[model samples]
Target: MQKLKWGMIGGGEGSQIGPAHRLGALADGHFELAAGALDHRPDAGREYAERLGVAPDRAYGDWTEMLEGEKGRSDRIDLVTIATPNSTHFEITKAFLEAGFNVLCEKPMTMTVEEGEEIVRVAEKTGKICAVNYCYSAYPMVRQARAMVQNGEIGKVRLVVTAFSHGHHGDATDADNPRVRWRYNPEMAGVSGQFADCGIHALHMASFICNDEVATLSADFASTIPSRELEDDAMVNFRMQGGTVGRLWTSSVAIGRQHGFDIQVFGETGGLRWASEQPNQLIYTPVGGRTQIIEKGEGGLHDDAQRLSRVSIAHPEGFPLAVANIYCDLADAIRGEIRDGLPNAADGVRSMSAVHTAVASAKDGGAWKDARPSIFK
Candidate 1:
């Protein structure tokens, strides 16, 4: 089997997303961490390299330099994993794609729809593998939900509901971690704070499971905290293109919650509910029967879900392992193997549009409009 050598663009010391990327990449063994440009800070980058045991010569202060210098090395890197702030995704990703390196990037594709379109253009123009880290798509139970819905096991999807809230310490005075830094900075995070940060994931989860996109939406949003520049909380209502009504409440200041990304898809015959906190199993309830707790890596699941569920049932698989599925699948794609299910730039564009629509609607007093169309198809 062809192997993929990996490099990281961010996840330096004290950064939240980077280490998560590193862990996911390492978890699957299909890829190797051969090089990295962990942070914009040189000292921090070096320290991260040491901590990761990456070679000093392959580490650099900038991702561009690493990409340019490594281009000719046959054994260096086949794929680049980006964990940078929202503002840098477009430019950095374009460079890497044009350089013929596959990419697995963080969500909220780019800061704007135009940039998102351009990223899709380049990825298609290059014919190289490009994927976004929508981790829920990797969940075996999530796959089961998607399969059941698409295969008519749930009949027509009636409504989809998702709730993602995180009462983060970012806005708290007593607790200040670097993880909350980019989140509070509008320059780095762009417009609509925590919604884009984590809401993007929830949006993707809902759509991925139902196999649809938002047609129209209305939203209510607030910063909550007086001094903060970004929205700490929001409420969004929408209808997917196929007439499936939906509602979402994404917040960073919802007290008593921690990284909550949960969804429920209701259809004519039955429904399924899944939560990020509990990735190991999915709740399936029939119209007249009791709710069946469907566990991953078990019998009676779709072939794709079974293959991705590498760990045995009861051993448990959550956030990190979900990401590992993406890592392994993308690596397989990069190496010229075809995987059954993997989220690509097309998923990114729809998610980007959903997020932009939610933000715009909230800003306009919960006004409704058609969500932006995907540029991929």
Candidate 2:
């Protein structure tokens, strides 16, 4: 199969996520970076595009120009990845989908639930694939865990606990610190701060692993730094559609935990545990039985897990490789293959709904609120 031609929006020079997307999208050589509107500034955009080896003519100053330029091109990009800030995702994604391009966008797909719904509607109307970068779902162990739960290896799921903790934001940021100002600013990061940034991943991980929808939830949020406009910590309690209990905690202000993402699911007869810090191992225990550690790419693993494993079990694969899996799956999907386990527009909607509900629950003094998964349907 031919490599897909791809473009990007945002991810200018020095931006964290943009380069990751580029590297991940091209990791397997299934895609080529054909164009991009890499920055808001014309000079910067052109420079950044050149830095990525994009042809000068293909690089545009802004998304509008990129869309307009690609519209009339004989060799148009097959897809565009949006690595921009939260506030800008809706317009960029909607515009691309309307222009007949598939989109792979960053999570919390839009700033608001309404915008997410609109994106979903446009995607369905256009018959274009819209994937959200819920990259954790791409991890081999995560897939293995999901498969184990689905195959009844753990019996009926009874409870789940997930968390994402980081110490990067533990100290208050100075207004002049450009690195994290947008994240602390509501204008850029939307209503929920740490939760929107990392909590959504936790939520998605649970849902993806359990194959269940979060039915109702209550949340509490707090900003450790007084100067910040949004919360740096969030705690949520919820019930899944199948009556499984769950709790999620996302905190950027945690003093000692750095990227401490972990999830443990307990079922009627046994339990399973996986942590992001150690992506290669999965711990499973049957009732009254000894614990077993499952390694990625090892024998006895599910085919889904083995398929996602890029290298041998001992050879580690982390975030970038997980992202590459999504990109590869997108390429398969584009080529008319049955792509399972890829997060699509509906997942995006459901995730954003979880965010909105969690924020609302926090605001309403921790009252239980519905996540409204029905919106995806």
Candidate 3:
């Protein structure tokens, strides 16, 4: 297949996410890095973009410059990925979508629910795609889990329990690290920290796998490190619109945990489990049967799972490949193919609503609050 022209904003040199975006976007040969505003600094961004093979003219300084540069080009980029900071997502996504470009924005999508709602409106008005990078949802086994729920293989989902926790920031000494500090600073990370960062991923996973939207939630947040203004740990209890019970725990201070994200779904007739650490397998147990491990590339897997499983069974397709599945879906969507599993602006806004509601609930002593955005409500 011919490659789609792609551009990117942020995810510059030394950025934790930059390499992943580069690798994922190009991995399946669906997209070519044609333009970029890769760094906050003009010279650095231009230099890095050139090193990454973006042409001199297309390697712009910042998002605004890239927007104007790409806007009038005869062969402008078919899509742009916004991997910038959380605060800039709303503005950049809105601008690109309004300019008649498809976008894949990093999660949070926006710092505020209002901003998220506005982006949703703009995308609708412009008839453009505004996808959020909930890439974990694109994992092959996760797709299998979602498929099982939709096919009633697990019966009606009764509950979902999930967590996205890590110990990288547990030490007090790292509290002052610029990378660690900004995540808890209100000015940078916005209203909530761990809950907004890792928690939403888990929450999204629950909604994704259960094929239900979160309706209401109660939460408890803690700033385990006294110096931080936002919570480093959070526990949330939620009810899905379909009455499925949900529980999520996310923390940056859970010592010894590494990329600790996992989810389990309980249903009337069976239970299913999957973890990021073991992305290739889904554990399953029927109401009265032995537990089975469903491998990603095994026979009888759902079409979605099988289609996205690039390698053979027992082989590992890690984080970047999960992200590549997202790009694959985007490429198909851009070509006028309907991909129901692709996460979009609606999903983005819902997550923002949940984050804000969780913040309010945590502050109010874990009082339950509606989690849907006002527009959805």
Candidate 4:
């Protein structure tokens, strides 16, 4: 199979997400990083590009320069991954999509619902792929959960309870940290902070695994750190299609907790529990039966789960593999191969809608609000 030529924007030196994107793109070998604007500073970007072993001629100082340079090339990038700040997502994605390049963007796809919808419109008009990186959905057990929920193994999901917590932001001093300034700045991270950054992932995961959509929500949000401009914690009560009720608690200031992405879905006949910390195995309890640990590559798993598992049950697959699976799925989609469950632009809008509406609900004293209307049809 021919590898697709790939380019990247952002993910400069010391950026946590940049290496993850690089490792993910390299993991499947279906795409190659041909070019990049690794940082805003032209010199740093070029240096970083060279460090990544990219040809010096292909690296550009900024996104516009890279796009302009690539547009004139015979060996143009087939796709570009945007790992920049939340505020930049709209313009970068639009530019690439307008240039007829497929886009894979990190989430909180856009800062506003209108911007996210505009992306959907542009992707539809361009006929190019636009995927959002909700990487948790790519986990083997997550795939299993989705399949089982859809196949009635869970017998009609009636409720979902999800919590994602991290103590990394617990330090009040971080409010003034130059590194995380964008996270606390509303203009950069948008109207919401912790909820927009981490809560949406939990929201998306619940809907994804349950094959449901969050219809409406009531929310409470707080910025625990003094002088912080955005929220660090959020509690949302939501209802999904077919009467599935759920709650989501997301916090960046949960002292002593780190990477606590956990979910529980209960149906009439059984329930399933999965956590990011224990990604390779799912805890399943059938009504009136003993609890079971369903590991990856084990029997009783669906084809979707088996297909995503890259190693044996005990080997353990986590974040990098999850991202690789997303890249692999994107590669399949780009090749026009049959694939399912890669979060596309519409899904991105769904999550962004939740983010927006949750902020609105919180601001309005926890009043109920409807999520963004589904634009697909």
Give residue 7's lDDT in candidate 2 (0 to 100): 94
Q: In candidate 2, which residue ranges exceed 4 Å CA deviation?
A: 173-176, 373-377
**TM-score (C-alpha, index-matched) for candidate 3:** 0.99
Query: In terms of TM-score, which candidate is strongest?
Result: 3
**Cα lDDT for residue 326, candidate 2:** 94
Candidate 1 stretches greater than 4 Å from native: 169-182, 374-377
Mind giving the per-residue lDDT tens digits that candidate 3 earns over 1-377?
A: 78999999999999998888889999999999999999999999999999999999999999999999999999999999999999999989999999999999999899999999999999989988899999999999999999999999989999899999999999999899999999999999999999999999999999999989999999999999999999999999999999999999999999999999999999999999999999999999999999999998989999999999998889999999999999999999999996989999999999999999999999999999999999998
Per-candidate TM-scores read 0.93, 0.97, 0.99, 0.97
Clashes (N, CA, C under 3 Å) per candidate = 1, 0, 0, 0
What is the lDDT for 68 in model 4? Answer: 95
lDDT of 1 at 43: 72
Q: Output the worst ten-in-a-row residue range by lDDT, candidate 2.
A: 172-181
Q: Judge candidate 1 at residue 286 and give its lDDT.
A: 90
Checking candidate 1 for backbone clashes, the offending pairs are: 11-18
Clashing pairs in 2: none
Least accurate 10 contiguous residues by lDDT in model 1? 169-178
Candidate 2 versus the native: TM-score?
A: 0.97
Q: Name the 10 consecutive residues with the lowest summed lDDT in model 3.
A: 16-25
lDDT by residue for model 4 (265-331), tens: 9999999999999998899999999999999989778988998888876998879889999999989
Which of the two candidates, 2 or 3, achieves a greater lDDT against the reference? Answer: 3
Instruction: Write down the RMSD of candidate 1 (Cα, Å).
Output: 2.1
Cα lDDT tens digits, model 1, 20-79, are 777888886777788889888877786787678788888877887888878988686888
